[model samples]
Target: GYILSYNGGNIVNAKTGEKLFAQFLPDEVIPILYRYAKEKNHALLGYAGNEIITEMPDDQYVKEESRINKMNIRKVENLFEALEPHPTKLLMTGDPADMLKAENELSEILGDRMDIFRSAPFFLELVPKGIDKAKSLLRLLSKINLTPADMIAFGDGYNDLSMLKLAGMGVAMQNAAPEVRAEADYITLSNEEDGIAAALEHFCKRIFKSKRLKFRMWFKYGLKAQKLLAQGI
Candidate 1:
């Protein structure tokens, strides 16, 4: 009965969809990222999607921002001064080669308290400490009197891994990364083949299947029964 949104950086719920749950980057982490952006001569963008975007004409991308043309671009000489209001998400653009150096600087500031994901060649997403899709899902589940074990999650990306693993059944798309596939409870067809629906159907079929009686080999029978079963006895 709730709308789960990730755009606000964490799980958020609002009937109008314009409201954010107020989850934001850690106060300390923001300055480090902003400082890095400044030193690298990079452009920093706060994802206040509702302010700039209207409709998603397609399923994959945010195309509405293009219609509005120029966004509310701001120049911040102070670097860290811009985030005083604390936006929903943080995105930074810079030379791809400098990503490691910038990341290392952030790490030095806060260790593993923040996550900087390379979502694109030139773009990095900054998420604060103790904030992630899975953690937020857990909170939501608590409200509904459900647990992670009661959920069946599907995904194909690295960011989706945490949520997938937390679910009772983690279904990985066939096109998912190799590490993602390894962590999945089951692997389904690629998205092009309607993988989500196919996997759901398969799950239903398995769930409703009748049990078959089979021989139960006892350890007392030892090697003989094991050998017989191995020989299709």
Candidate 2:
């Protein structure tokens, strides 16, 4: 089994805890991010390995993130130094309006080199280009000789749009964003109502019935072909 995290920026073996694939922000971009954080007075958190590193120990955003993720927040004098070498992703936290503005500015600044998007109203994430759930899932599928047609994806956020589109059947929760719901093949109950389980149960039954019908049709056509061949037609 594999776990795809950081919006597919990192893929790891579930049991062994070994990374099968990973992407990182460019080394030069770190300083630019830090400078922007300072200029905008936003708290930036660097995600490297299992740690969340930041310079603002007392920032409300940082504290809230620590509590939400249930991970220890490491404070350092210099975020750049603490995240030496590279980081998998960066999170900029501030007011929703400020983050929205930052997203547009960073998109122009980074161009095609990086992917900048919002995971929440006040959380903007910066990651390497082409790092998303669909792309990463494709890579993993190729390793096992599978394809997107074999996948059934479920999602609720904007970030999940690509993955939902790429799968054979895309399921959106009732609470999913409007855009997400529009793109999904099916919509199920909200997360609070065991949406995933409900979808699996519904789709699984239909899949089995469809497979049985296809098999019967194949058998019918196959017998006709065999009879024609036997009769020298």
**Top model number, TM-score:** 2
Cα-lDDT of candidate 1: 0.63
What lDDT is reached at residue 151 by model 1?
96
Q: Across residues 122-178, which tens digit of lDDT does each residue of candidate 2 receive?
A: 788898988999999998999878999999899987888999999999999998879
- In TM-score terms, candidate 2 sits at 0.78
Q: Give the residue spans of candidate 2 off by over 4 A.
A: 56-70, 205-233
Question: Which ranges of candidate 1 are over 4 A from the true structure?
Answer: 7-9, 14-21, 27-31, 41-43, 51-84, 93-101, 117-123, 208-233
Evaluate all candidate structures by whole-model CA lDDT and list the values in order.
0.63, 0.87
| lDDT of residue 184 for candidate 1 | 97
Which candidate's lDDT is highest?
2
